[model samples]
Target: MAARIDEEITFRKLEILLAFLEAGSLARAADALGVSAVSVHRALHSLETGTRCSLFRLEGRNLQPNDAAHALADVAREVLQTMAQGIRSTREIAGYAADRIRIGSLYSLTSGTVPALIMALRLRKPDIQTELVLGSNSELLRKLRDGELDATIMGQPEGTPDIESQLLFEDEIFFAAPAGSPYAAQSAIDLAQCSDERFVSLNEGYVTHDRFRDAFRVAGFEPNVVMTTNDIFSLMNLVGGSIGCTLLPGRIRSVLPRSVCLVPLLPAFQMRQKISVSFLRTRERDPNLLSLLAACRSHAAERPLASG
Candidate 1:
């Protein structure tokens, strides 16, 4: 039978060996590594047993490294360096982009959510670079699933088994109308009452569009969607121009056109989206994603989020 993992020399054993050599004493090594002295002693003894070589000598009460130990230390340093380089090279070749994080997000989140996430992430990883790709929910999620993005910030995927999501915050979906539009003065709007209005919504692939269709369905009417655009800016422009009305999220309220307004939907037509840091289930433990997820949790804690 092959030797068990405990019986074989390992990377951890090599690291302990190097630590002991530099620290010069088992107690010192233990302190340096934040481990028990017994553990440091055992790792060295275990490594010596695996090699069947005399790696240490007892000089009075102190244990000192022998020729074999010094020789192995040299080899261990090179082995660790080469292995680390190889792993980094492999990750790069496979499009992992270790030094750069590729992010995809909905345009509406740019004003607040995405910027906060990236800023918080920088506190942990100052040298890391980020590339942002903005699109509708569907396009961003597709890029995430295809491995074209390292992670994405968007509405949580519904029943997506292959993806993992960590909720950052919840945002209300509201009725958007220009200031001078006929319906802008209303304190609250109900979707059912606006069936005859000309609506210009985002194109078919956005999460907001999904909510748009669902809300109208519950209201017992097909929306008179007279125009559709893929750009949130253009959609907002159309609304600001009073060309048509549409639904939008509350996160972009600060950036809404000076003449446009976001009116809350009445209780009966109210809907909310859970904005999250989403990634592939396979990348749940990726370092960059782990940092981003941490940033999401931190960001959520700082905000006076919408309550359930």
Candidate 2:
């Protein structure tokens, strides 16, 4: 008689368990999942606890899956396959048939790049519909990996090999301050010169937020962060209010209020964010995805070079 798997075990846990079985190691499974090894270990431990069974045996620091683990993995594979097929069939029957492309993008791009791309795509395929989701870079990448989004426009994704990306354009980062601030008069300033200045930044999980921190690291000082918010516009508003200075991409210059001044960073301290259209490589052949990718490429080619 076979042991019953825990009903509380989630599909994600099962997927992790199956990954462990196939990869034969936690680190390899984590690599495949685009997560940390600690995450894999936690999932596996949770699965074992929920099942109340020893699915793996530790042998000289390596976890070896037992027979029970193999059986569970087999079941997990079948379940996932069935779910995928069911979803595809339902969508087909509903006349959706992948006609709608769900795209994710960074909040900042929604104002210009996203709208332009959507307009161009609509012109090319009037019958198609697009759903645009805005989020931080890490959030969008996670959605893309989980199959929640067909593709995403974001800064170049790092450490995520499962995603294939095409560079759209290069955007330069600029130092932003209140219009009346002394820094506004300079043509270019080194980041170190702003070491004592209060900074307003995006919250963690944003690519720009990471880049902001990196700038501070390069400048050899910790930033005096006075505010952290999720919205780029809100951060800009704070800068305009003279709350603190910030680093922003040139693409946002059109929306900047006159109260805010954007100054160029010295060449040595300058940073550029490479915006890209990214999607799971597995969906490269889907007709709708292909169309969207083509539109993105076209739009990127037509965009003007980033100004300082």
Q: Note the clash tally of each candidate.
A: 0, 0
> Between which residue pairs do clashes occur in model 1?
none
Error of 2 at 238 (Å): 0.4
- Tell me which residue pairs clash in candidate 2: none
Q: Which ten-residue region of model 2 has the weakest summed lDDT?
A: 91-100
Per-residue CA lDDT of model 1 for 1-308, tens digit only, reads 97664455999889999999999999999999999999999999999888988999999999999989999999999999999999899886544648889999998888778888999999989988999999888888899878789898988899999999988888888999988876788999978889789889998888888888878888899888878999888899999887789988887888888889889888888888888889998887778888888998999998866722
Candidate 2 lDDT, tens digit per residue, 120-201?
7787778888888999998999888787888899898987778898888888889999999998999997898777899999
Candidate 1 TM-score to native:
0.75
CA lDDT scores, all candidates in order: 0.87, 0.86
